[model samples]
Target: MNRTQFLRLCALGAALAVGGPAALAQTYPSKPIRLVVPWPAGGGADAVGRAVAEALRVQLGQSVVVDNIAGAGGNIGTQQFIRQPADGYTLLLATSSTNSANPYLYKRTGFDPVKDFTPVASLAVIPSVMIVAAGAPYKSPADIVQAAKATPGKLSYGSGGVGNSAHLAGELFKSIAGIDVIHVPYKGSSPALTDVMGGQLDYMLDTGAYGQLKGGKVRAVAVASATRHPLLPGVPTFEELGIKGMQMNAWYGLAAPAGTPAAIVERLNGAVQAAFQAGDLGKRLTDVGAELRPGTAASFAAFWNAELQRYAGLVKLTGATLD
Candidate 1:
């Protein structure tokens, strides 16, 4: 009779009309859920995916298994992911790169991020940091800019590869700062970071390199955020330093294949928010330099759209392309 009961009954009737496994949105996840992490094992995406799965498992009272389908810069796995049934049991560990940037960077992503997926909830954001050797001469963003201007093409930065977040950030910095620098692409971020630490490269902007920032291994000159991150409070943000349009963050989230039940999406998003509210999952993400992001499905969708637009401009600004 009450509004809550009426809504529940409506959802139940709709589920029954569909008449299948997806009809039970109220009691969904009767079995283990599959979380597809479109990245390699032992990587940042893998770690966050596993952590999210564990938290969801605890919150939903069902196991959440991880499946890594990494290749072709996270495009091959996504191509397969879109084929999954629009059931709540399957989810994608979505990232800014997979959902926002790849479409603009790659000629064929095989999946339409906007049309083929349903935004569930945003999990966390990993901001980029401009890092140099602990003993490097560049003390700040200004210092780096000065050196680049003086030496022109002599200053170089390394990245995981072309069209990667690091490369895009570096290019944005180059464009805004009006400096000439070389971009050295590597097979992976590890080797690129190694070159930075070994003095072979001048700087490297990255999200996954936070683990290497301790013990004076590297000096963080500036963070690509509107405000200072707790992990690096002493380091100023690019915005605060009078550099605009530098708030680059790699946001992670949970998304389901398009056409999934609205009740199911709401239920799963509740679990995501509850998992963060439980404190353990947020702490786990924070330990690795990720800022917690709690949002509804609607908000996540809006954020995704805005990010897609932003990435489109970024791709055009950098003239970055992948075959």
Candidate 2:
């Protein structure tokens, strides 16, 4: 071959060499994938994570395992996932607590929520319900608001922990409704709701933890969303009561450590999105008071960032700080 022909052939070979691995990475999950659930077993996040993993196993033709790494308000497991090689083999179950709220709540977090992770896709969003104990004096939302206004800090709301979604939801209610209610933090939502039922806590903001309401333990006052939830048909949304812009939905998404290959990220996102639309996963999520929210990586990044800013402002407005 002539010199020019040889030079062109060499260029073509180099292009193929660079593009080959990119194409291979696109066919990711050639083996089992590890999905980390940062919460303890049997809660909403754990249940949802296992369902998604099972659906993904079918989609990817490989075993998808859910490893529960609970503690430190989900930061422990999340930080461990970030320590993994960003190769899509390892993923973290991202939640409102893990992604947006806890970073500001803790004095020092091991990983930068926005910086250390790349969004895969949002899995689902769990709506918080305004619930009061069955025997509480406040039979209506108006009654609770009026009582709060009248007593200021005397009325209280219990939450899972400091800076949890439930905690933020309570603060949001106080800000828009112009009430002063004391926020009591508990170790978890179960205990928080426990006290609410026992009359120790006046009310609480909680997610649909099942049995909490189905067993006639508490009365749902309102849903903290734009529309009323089907599970609690009788409950009204804050928006319907003329409380506009009072939207707070705790969400869960999927994320891989930063520096993961773009092709791998796309593959994982596709698998998750497909699983969400598969057989009973979406229905199950909805049944548990969560809506399936599927979106691309860029979309999730934008969503998460906006939530961070919004919550930061709300935290400031509530004058809530943890140290």
Q: Give me the candidate number with maximum TM-score.
A: 1
TM-score for candidate 1, residues paired by index: 0.85
Residue pairs of candidate 1 with colliding backbone atoms: none
Off by over 4 Å in 2: 1-27, 149-154
TM-score of each: 0.85, 0.84
Give me the displacement of residue 148 in model 1, in angstroms: 2.7
Quickly count the clashes in candidate 2: 0
Best by lDDT: 1
lDDT per residue for candidate 2 within 1-323, as digits (tens), equals 99998997787567647786565454566679999988766666777788788877887888989998877778888889999998788988888876788877787879987889988888888888888898998876789999888888899898766777788888878877888888887655667778898999888777745557888888887788877887888888878877776777778888889998777888878877787767566877776788778889899989999888876777777666652
Evaluate model 2: give its TM-score. Answer: 0.84
